[model samples]
Every structure is written in structure tokens, then in C-alpha cells.
Target: MPQSAVDSPDLRLTLRVRAMRREARDVLSLELDDPAGGLLPPWEPGAHIDLRFANGVERQYSLCSDPADRTAWRVAILAESPSRGGSRYVHQTLRVGDLVTVSAPINHFALTPAAEYVFVAGGIGITPILPMLAEATRRGIPWRLAYLGSLAERMAFLDLPQLAGGDTLLVRGDLDTRLDLTAWIGSPTEQTGVYACGPERMLDALEQLSLDWPRGALHVERFQAKTFGESQGADTFEVVASRSDLVVSVDRGCSILEMLENAGIGVPSSCLEGVCGTCETAVIDGAPEHRDSILTPDERESNETMMICVSRSLGDRLVLDI
Candidate 1:
């Protein structure tokens, strides 16, 4: 048997916590090791890693380091105690010189190789965008970054402008007072692809603003899940797993994948927020009510697959080939 090229390992780099500092009130910057032998992965600007600790607590954090460095990747973590234990562990327990296993870089938010780029970052969401700013600077891509934060020091990558050589825009003030999304995003040229990553409010605002722009021109990555409550919107949907047929009764708040997982069905998932395409499943028969951000319109129309984590059946009854 031969291995498929896609299944082969990409650039897998062992990153050690070289330094940790308070980037903001709640955010912490973690500098990783470059490895003595120059062992590192080639990554694009918006790539991130699945960091695995000894306790098997793994979380995905966007790489904040410059891609050109090639020696190391930096990630910033905002401690969320109520959620996954990764951030808490990283912030409280993980220290300098501590080693953590990181998967090969994966990119969901990417620069579309346009003539010019506009980057918007809010709060700790600036991690991934920082690298893109660096890339735009290095390539002379005519880029501008609107870094909006409550305070100037809260924004860790202050050196971006110097690195970018005046090709950057740093807007520091209370988001309520300082943020001007329309003026920043609306004024951009049609060819510009707007890239944004930030808190839900900011992303939602950007999403609304994006509605006015041309499709495929606005790219965003959300770090949190939509709180739709436990009530699934649809009644009684059946999902047909390729391995087995399971007709699960879906309440208004119950998602198809949640039903399956509750029934002891194992489906691959991470970030259950629909940002990561880990829980994607094939749709055998049914119109999918897609809630995920990953799928394109063509892919959704094809009706071949659905990200079971957040997506649901469009029709009353969906038969998914799980």
C-alpha cells in the first residue's frame, strides 16, 4: 500500500516555550524555540498549530511569528477557564523551556494573493494577522493593517510598523471611540481582500459590513462558537452513517453531530465552532443547512459533505452518510 501525498506529514516543528509575557490584560505571548538544527516548517501567514501537552490537552493557537523566520513560531493565548483546559494550562502551568507537541501548520484564513490587502485585528485576534502584515511588508504588497485595541500597549506587535516601514496603520483607543469599520473597510478598492480576526462582536460587525462588499472579498476567522442554546431548530432528522444507519431524533436545539456523539458515534471534530473543518461529513441525502464558515457555495450546492459540528439539515429530514 502506498501513502497518499495529502496524508503525508507536512512541516511538523517541535516548539518549546522560549518566553512568556503578558501581551495585554488577558493575553500572553509565547515564543517558541527555533530548534538548534534550524528544523522548522514553511508556513503561510495565517497558519496555526494544534499544541499538545503531556496531559493530552490540545488547543489550536494562531502562529503570530513572522513566516520568514522559519526558525520558530510564536503564539499568544488568552486564558479561558470555563472552556478547554489548554489556555489555562499554557498560561498558568506552562513555563519557559517547557516542550509541547505541535502539529504541522494548518491554514484556514489565508491571503488570496491579491494586488493589495487590508487587515483588521481586534483584541488578541491580532496573532494571525501580524504574520500577514510582515508578509505584506516583505513582498511590498501594498498592504495596510488597522490594529484596533483599547490601549496601545495591549497590542503586542507594535514593531509591525517599523517592520512594515510605514505600510501599516495602528489605531489604538477604546473600540467604541476609535473603531471605524466602514471608513476602513468600505474605502478599500474592490480588488482588495479584507482579512479580519477578532472577537465575535467585531467579526459580526465585519460580517455585516462584508455583505455590502463583493463576495469572496472578505475573509474572517472566529475564535468562539455561536451560542444557539441547547434547542436544535429542526424536528426529527435522520442521519445515515456509511458504517451504520442511525436515525436520531433531533430536537430544535440538537445538532446532527451532537445527536450522533450522544449516541456514542465518533466523528472527528476540533474547535466545534465550524472554523476548523475537522468534523466534515458526507451528505448522502438531504439539503444541508450549513452554518460553518469553511464551505464555499459550490461545495454546499454539491451537497456531498457537511460539517456536522455546526451545520444541519436544510430540509425536515436529512440522511447523512456519516
Candidate 2:
């Protein structure tokens, strides 16, 4: 299948919750399977699926299970106290045997070929790294892990057999030991690939510290939307759908997505906040003032695509491959 098909919003599968188990405090691991006992779509490490709830709420969760397991897909979710209803619904309302609509696994954070790997995960961020550990082990690649949590009891999947080794460091908040990124992440080398998933503060620190590192040496996945510094002062712009041969004017106060919908053009969108990768349209012409958290600095420089939900044209007109 095409990459676009894999990322398409119209692609949805109804799967049954085969089992649910509590992994840690306020965290639950759910196993989803095809009700017909058939094989599910294959996924690589760092891929996530969008879970559509009955109440029309949608949330993305990273696949934590081994990618080799085609029979089932597993995701661990943390129940946030002030959740926008996604986590709470999974924790309180969702139950085993209930069918849920899930999208195909889409990976913006994919594992690249490297001689060695270094992984740093904080709290629930470890979910995506779990599968990466398995893949590295299978390929016999040298790897190390630093897993951090508030407490020992709150750290999920610590008891997993794969985590047993001297290379794996388990740090807790209540203890005196702390995660020092400066000390843990030394000067990045060409042979080493650094992957980190954590809170905004931790990611921010890592991003700043790795500035001098070799390009593409440091990779990160954020659980929250990035705080785009300062507004760009919104201005009216025009968008031309290359394929549709349609033109739409986006007002200063309105978004391109809103204007597209008004023109009867349907685009897949989930989190309109630019945190989710949905509504990412291919750019045929013109520069875009990228506002999405999912794209990297290099990707923004390429100008090959833009998330229409929050991003706008840098010039007066933008040509999109709709």
C-alpha cells in the first residue's frame, strides 16, 4: 500500500478488545485483535494508532508490543486526571470485548539504520521504545536505555525480561538519583543514534543540548504539542487544490481547513491543534509557515508538505496536491 493510504484518515478498522491489564498506577495495557481471528496490518517500531471512541473522541497511542506479533496489537494508556475525555473513556468506560474503531499504524518517528542506539524515556514515554528494544535485540545491535518515572511502583513494564541488564538504568523521582541528560547523552557520534520520548521540559532540554550534535543523530517524539514561539500575525491567503482544480480564500481569522470545508472539500482531521499528523497535505508550490509539532526542522526546510490545520501559506498563494 502507498504511504498516503497508510496515513489516510478514511482508513479505519474495527477491532475487538481481547484483553486489558493494569500495567502501573493509572496505566492500563489493552490488547486489540481482529474479531475474525485474521492477521492485522503490520507495523514497525514507533508507530501509533488512532483509537476512535464511541463518543466521537479520538486519541493516539503508541504500539508497545512486538511488531512480529501479527495476531494482536497492544497499547498502554495513562489516565490523565484532566484528560479531554480520551484517556478517561479508555480507563473508565472502555471494557474488554467492546469494539473500537482504530486507524492503521502511522509512524512519524521511525527507527533509522545506525551502528548503535541510545534510548531515553520518561514516564509513559517508554511505550514506543519497548518495541524498539525488541527490534534492536533481534538485529543484535548494541543499545542502552534510561527509563525514568516518578516512583518505582509507577514505572510500567519494569519487570519485563528484556529490561534486565547493566545497560538499562531505572531512575525514580522519590529517590536521590536523577536523570541528567547532559551526563547521559554525551557528544553524539556518527555511529550513535539517540532516541528520546518524554515530557516537554525534558524534550526541550534534549533539543537544546543536541544542537551541536551531528545532523540526524538526535531524534525525539513529543507527547504534547510544541509551544510555537510568538504568533506570526495571521494574514489572508489563497490555496489552490492542484488535483481538484479549486481555489479557496482563507481569511485572517480562519484556518485553511475551515476554508476548505466551506468549499466542500473534505480533509481528514483529528486534533486540530497540530499535535496529530492528520490533515498533512502535500505542497506542490509556495512556502508554508509551518506550525505543526510533528515535523522536524529539516522537514520544514524541505517544504514538501504542511499540516493544513494550523499551518498557512507564507506567500499569498499556496498550491497543494489535494
Candidate 3:
């Protein structure tokens, strides 16, 4: 179901910033390439890479450039108002030609085959949709995009020519502008899929509208970990790292990832809050309480893999592929 293939989740590379450009008022776009002039790993639409800054801060940014262009990878970073160290570092300290540590691409928001596609992007959420649109055009897939931005000057990729056409709708204004979600998306039909990415409130509104649609109709990606209240029914559980031949006891306050890391078993990970799918571990056996933000409803129901960072066991024991 729309699940993107992760080539190598633990693959890391050192790349140099080939160039930097100001796409918008607060947006900085960086083009990364190998210093030795070599091709990088191939990725698809809705894929993102984890960039580890010089300051040792890691953050995931969507691949906004054409996936076919393997010469270089592009990502846009918004100068976050609160300055979470990542945005500030990229804007102020990171420079062109600087070496950076980057993780291989990961995709939890892959675009699946559909008769018709609908995309809704809000502000920086437009990053992943850029490549999706390119792929859709290459495949001759019928699609429409609704780009909503708070301010005209702050929006990125405004100069993109692909966005100018009847198939796309651009709405820019302040907080006062109200969008009719139902009319914009219309009634769902057979084989019609909707992909949306934005702030919590924006996604929340869409979620409300999706209640009437068929299951697995609407797909979304989040910029942050959703608020899941305190752990409930969380008791001590045991995890068997099958590959490592070790069994670790997980405490109520501790997580499976933490337990493995503490036991000298490293699971290549980033965004330990479960927003990133770095710590996704294969579940050989046992039921897991999935709490990650990356998986689809169908994927969760399948219980094939579990994000050890935030997810836990639903039973007394869990067997992991590690």
C-alpha cells in the first residue's frame, strides 16, 4: 500500500554543499553533491534525507528536486522562528562547499498508483509534493494541486513554471482566508487518492473531512511528532533482538531503542521522537502497539514492522529482527 522502498536506512554519506540559493524570504535551498563528483543513491518522491549539521544537530528535509537528476540532491530549509538549532545552523553557520553528514533517503509518504491524485500543500509542506508532481507528469498521471501559503513572499518555489496551469490552484493570503475543504477536494470516488502535508491544524482539518471518505483515501506527513498522551497500560515488556541474540528488558520510562542502545546494540536512528522512520525495526513475532507517525493505517494493521523509538509491545514479549 503506497509504502516506499527504503534502499538502505542506515547508509550515511559525507557530501558537500554544491550551491545555496534563497528561494523565498525565509527559505534557503541547498544543493548537495559528492565532493569527488560521483552519483548519489537514487530516491523517489516523498523521500527525505537526514542532514547532520556541523553542530551535531540532525534534522530531516524533503528532497525537493527531480529524482532522476542523480547528480545532486536539493532540500529547502525554513528559518524556524523558534530556532531549533537546525534551522539556525543551516541559515547562519552552514556555508557552500561545507562537508555535511547525510543519511540515505527514507520515505513513509510514497505516492501510490491511482486513477486520479489530489495534493494539498501548506507552506514548507510543499517540498515533498514538488517531486511528486514531477513524477506524476512523467507518468502522465492526472493530478491537481492546492497550494496554500500564509504569505506570498514567504512561500518557496513560487517561480516554478510547472505550478502554472489549470491543474493547479494557488491560494495566498493571511489567516483570514478560509478554504472550503469539501469543494477543494470534492467527493471521493473510486481509485481517487488525496495526499496532504502541513501543520497540525491543517492536517487536523483534513482529517475531519476524511472521516466520510473511504479508508486509506487520504495520506499525510507530519513535520513533528503528534501529541500522544501519557503511555497507557504500559508495563514492563521484554524485547528479543533476534539478530543480536540478546533480550532486553524495557522499562516503563525507557523505550526499545534506548534499551538496545544501552545494551551496546546500535540501531541507526534520528528524530528519536518517532517522527522519522530511522529506528523502524522488523517484528518477527508478537503484537506491537504502533505509535509512530510514519505508517499508514493498513501498514499498522499488518504489524510487519515497528518503530522502536516510541512504540512498545502489546504483550509480554516481542521478537525483533533488529
Cα-based lDDT for every prediction: 0.72, 0.85, 0.86
Model 1 lowest lDDT segment of ten:
1-10
Sorted by TM-score (best first), the order is 2, 3, 1
Model 1, 1-322: lDDT tens digits are 1111122345335668778888776678888876464658778988877777767676778998878776667899887758478887877788898887777777878777878888888878888888787777677778777777877666676654533543566677844467577986665557887888888888778877777776677788778764444334355566666567666767666666778878777675666677766667887787877788766545778888887877876567777676
Q: Which structure is stronger by lDDT: 1 or 2?
A: 2
Q: Rank candidates by lDDT, best first.
A: 3, 2, 1
Q: TM-score for every candidate vs. truth?
A: 0.80, 0.94, 0.93
Regarding TM-score, does 1 or 3 come out ahead? 3
What lDDT does model 1 reach? Answer: 0.72
On the 0 to 100 scale, the lDDT of residue 141 in model 2 is 87
Cα lDDT tens digits, model 3, 25-71, are 99999999999999999999999998888897788999999999999
Tell me the deviation in Å of residue 284 in model 2: 1.3
Local accuracy of candidate 2 as per-residue lDDT tens digits, 1-322: 1122224646888899999999999999999999999999999999988888898778888999989999999999998879999999999999999998899888988999898899999999999999988888778888899998988777899888767532798898988478787887777798888888978888888889888888778888877888886546348888999888999998776788888878878788777777668788999999899988788778889999998888887788999999
